[model samples]
Target: MKTFQTVRGKLSGQILLWVLLAMSTTVYGQQSPITISGTITESGSGMPVAGASVFIENTSFGAVSDFDGNYSLNAQLENKDYTLIASYLGFTTQRITISITGDDLEKDIVLAEDLLSLDEVVVTGTGTGANRRSLGNAVASVKSKDLTNNGATQVDQAIAGKVSGALVQQNSGDPAGGISIRLRGASTISGSSDPLYIVDGIIISNSSNELIDLGGNSQNRLADLNPNDIDKIEIIKGAAAAAIYGSRASNGVVQIFTKKGKSGEPKFTFMTNVRLNELRKKIDYNTVPLAWEVATDRNNLATVEVERYDLQDAIFDTGFGLENYFSVNGGNEKTSYFLSASHLDNEGIVQNTDFKRYGFKANLTQKAFDWLDITGGFNYVRSISNDVPNGGINSAYGAITGFLFSDNSIDPTPDESGVYPVTSPLVARTNPMEAVDRFDFNQKTNRVITSIA
Candidate 1:
């Protein structure tokens, strides 16, 4: 009987030990942490996308991807039904629903680019990227295709009426006429009100005084840039949008981005255009008889009959323009190059006025390392202008003063007297033809601009 009791007590202790062991096992299972690991990649290229964020839906548990686009998260998941979300900028968000148990789980997600979404950002203000929908400022972007389609000569002219809130005005009818650009109306009380121009990360000085003093009284400096070489243009209107550019941008800012070579098979492009330009409008001058009668009345002299002259008919003519361009681009994955040459000849509607330019450009880009890129480009342009004397005394304006309102018909050629025979009230005024043949005004300019990045 004593032996039986001892065995029974031993069995009771063993059963109690077993019950405690089962309870401890159940509690451990409920508190264990599960690890979730995964990798993220681009759907199309299958390239790993680092810096992606992965998190459980509606929870504070999350992890960030490492350099290899791998992530690991630890969580004490209570429910089997839970969702994992992975997101990154410029890519579509990915979500996966799965059951969680007391075990490690592995997941791999592939994301695609969000092309249709306007949320894709662009750099508008200096070094700042903003969504297109949230911007309050007036900005317009013109692609390379637009400039080519319009056959625009200058960058500013390419964006003319197409963009809202920006005004482009042509000051003259000449082929080389000046253009005026205004952003949200004139803001300054006095001084130049033109916008600032930035080309290829270089801020160019657009001093109005300089334009007046050195540019032969041109309206803006944007005419210095050729449209064919431009890759894109961004116009920032109003002070608020251009504040970062400082005082130079008081009017506004126009940023120009030039084209560079692309890596691919060797490519060649050639284009030529032959354009004809005629006088769009003519200014009517007073008849010779009418002019002489008016002059006699003003001078209170006896009736003097004057010969008539068609001064307008003799000064203007139909002009022609010809342009030619050729380019060659070829490169490998490590290096690329682009070279272009262009020639332009344009004649003015007015006699003895013309413009010619020869330009060449070369751009090279090299990938020195995975994260380092180097680019260098240069442009050389030489222009010649054959200009007529149009202003000042004894100039084109003077010829108009003498011929149209003269007291007598004047012949443009010299008579046997070796003196310009005048039929007008003034004898000091020379014939328009004689002045044009004797006066020759010509100017030549050569410019070289280069950039390194």
Candidate 2:
């Protein structure tokens, strides 16, 4: 009877201990922590992107990438499924379904460049988006680097020879004058002849024709824009390519894209240039006699006294120019901004005639939300100019009627009545100094533009 009682007590005690061990294990399993580690790289270059964020989909557990794009996290659970998210600016997000185990987990992920992916998308003729491979019409794209390669002053000049099936001609070498562009020959005989210019999704009025007083004579509107500020230019040559732009685009369309900020540290740039201008061709006056000899030769026909005047020498002077530019660009993941200022001063080859301009520009873009984006930009300019009078055949400085050669004895100085002394009509017609003093004109322009997407 004593042996039976002892055996029963020992069996009961062993069973109780087993139950306790089972309960302890259940609690410990719930409390064990999990470790996750991963490395991130660019899809194309296989280059690690440091500072990328890696975290659980709906939890606070997260880690920042190190220099090698490696990250680690500790979680207080095991044998469970969770969503892991990795993100970096300028790259597409990466997600993976991961089941945690008691042991440490490792993963390697690659992210695609978002800009390259977005660029591949194409837009249909009906304002709908399509892929580039599916398009049927002829289309071309001009990159920003290509526009900036050659030092061109105007965007039209940059595209002159670079593009095919387009004709660009400069009618004259006048500074700030217009350039003529014809795509596939003349479509209209009496109406506007130049192609329409679109800038940053806005239809800007190009006054190349109006600049010359409705074809009377004027400068090209394209020359008003500084080419250095342009990012890219796209040309639509065919009717099929310009169908989306509506009636205004019948003559073809020239689209311009300006520079914007990128995701990077703030950068500052400065550029300056100095140029000298001289007469491309010199006039010959050796065949003409002195003003006195001419006056003596015409004595029989002259009723009023003829004085000497050196009009040719008084009209021309040495020309010099200077240009300066400074800019800054920077941005965070959500917002980017660009600011620039420039100054241009050009002295004309004609005495006392010159042009000066100062300009300011800014561009700002913000990712207001996940599906909304906003952009705004502005340009302001102030200009002052002094031009010689260009009138009829007898006009003082008309290129066609102005005398290239004049007699040497004609003095340009004024007489006692504050009036320029008159000499022979062929030798000296008007005082060039008087014409410069009387002609002066000033103009200023300011432009503002904004868009949302």
Candidate 3:
């Protein structure tokens, strides 16, 4: 009886100890994790600062504040005291010593204004510009140096391959040809897809008016504006631009800012440049001395010996271009003025094809009152071109068409009488030498643009 009582007492004590151990482990597993939470506010007005970053120093634990300036971080802290940091844009960063033990800690951080922070100013299609950091749309800006570095005389040529999602296409190989731009692909099938152009807040025409047809080739009026006079260019595309510019900006918007006078003594600048344009590749022509005889009946044809002539060298030549630009600018605290002039001459690869342009510009600004300023701008351009038919379908007088459709047996060199013989009688019915030498086509334009604000 004594042995049985001792065994029962020992078993009951062992069960009681195991029950206490399990209960202690359950309590430990149910304990909540430590968390650090805080609200970030401005120092002066105590306004909640959203999008602020709150983090623990030297650790990967961090969180961003919500719209209400509330933030929470789960910290598996190994140290007794940790350094909490809060940082925001245009605001001074704050750091404080924090302690996390067995309970959650609440911290409220105040960020002071960073007086030295300067945001970039960006043109947002509005009269008053906005900060670049605060804008949500994509806006690309190109400086004058970047636009003119590639020896470009025309504005379209200067912007080629410099902007994102902007495609520039030359319609013809003529020195004074038109350019087509597609900002967001073909937005409309029948309507014009060209982007709206604004120069110094004034809408300008970019139409390609062809007074005479040169095989469907025309000149864009935008070429009249010299690239040297540009200060910068801003491009805005997609729905963001349409909301501000309406249906006219369905394709995009291009804003050009001309150079303005600086507040200093008079400054003069002179620049001259020369460029060369050459053919990329030549077509491989068959130089064999044998060809199929031109028999009226194909079944009764015979091989005939002939002299194959190569006319590519005679049709194309190295092009030359020359440009001169001059400018003077000056201003005081109350008044400023800028004046510039430029001249350009370009020769095309085809013989007797050339382009010339003369441009002048003036900009003036006056401060009438402490809070008001008046500005005005004037621009003039004269363009002349010796054009040729180099584009579109098979026209008998087309420079390139006549050469491509001509026979290798027919020579393009003029005879002792200085008369060019027909090269393709059945097809183009014109000779390449005649088109390049005798065909005279001319185009001239005089335009003036003015703006006041």
State the TM-score for model 1.
Answer: 0.65
TM-score per prediction, in order, is: 0.65, 0.60, 0.71
Worst ten-residue run, lDDT, model 2? Answer: 208-217
List, residue by residue over 60-166, the lDDT tens digit for candidate 3: 88999999999999966653677788899878566667866769899888776643232455565666566656655566778889988888778888999998999
Q: Per-residue lDDT for 291-319 in model 2, tens only?
A: 24344575655344444444555666677
Total clashing pairs in model 3 = 0
State the weakest 10-residue window (summed lDDT) of model 1.
Answer: 208-217
Q: Which candidate is the best by lDDT?
A: 3
Every candidate's lDDT: 0.69, 0.64, 0.82
> Candidate 1's C-alpha lDDT?
0.69
Q: How close is candidate 2 to the true structure, as a TM-score?
A: 0.60
Ranking under TM-score, best-scoring first? Answer: 3, 1, 2
Model 3 stretches with alpha carbons more than 4 Å out: 1-121, 130-136, 415-419
Pick by lDDT: 1 or 3, better one: 3
Preferred candidate (TM-score higher): 2 or 3: 3
Judged by TM-score relative to the true structure, which candidate is superior, 1 or 3?
3
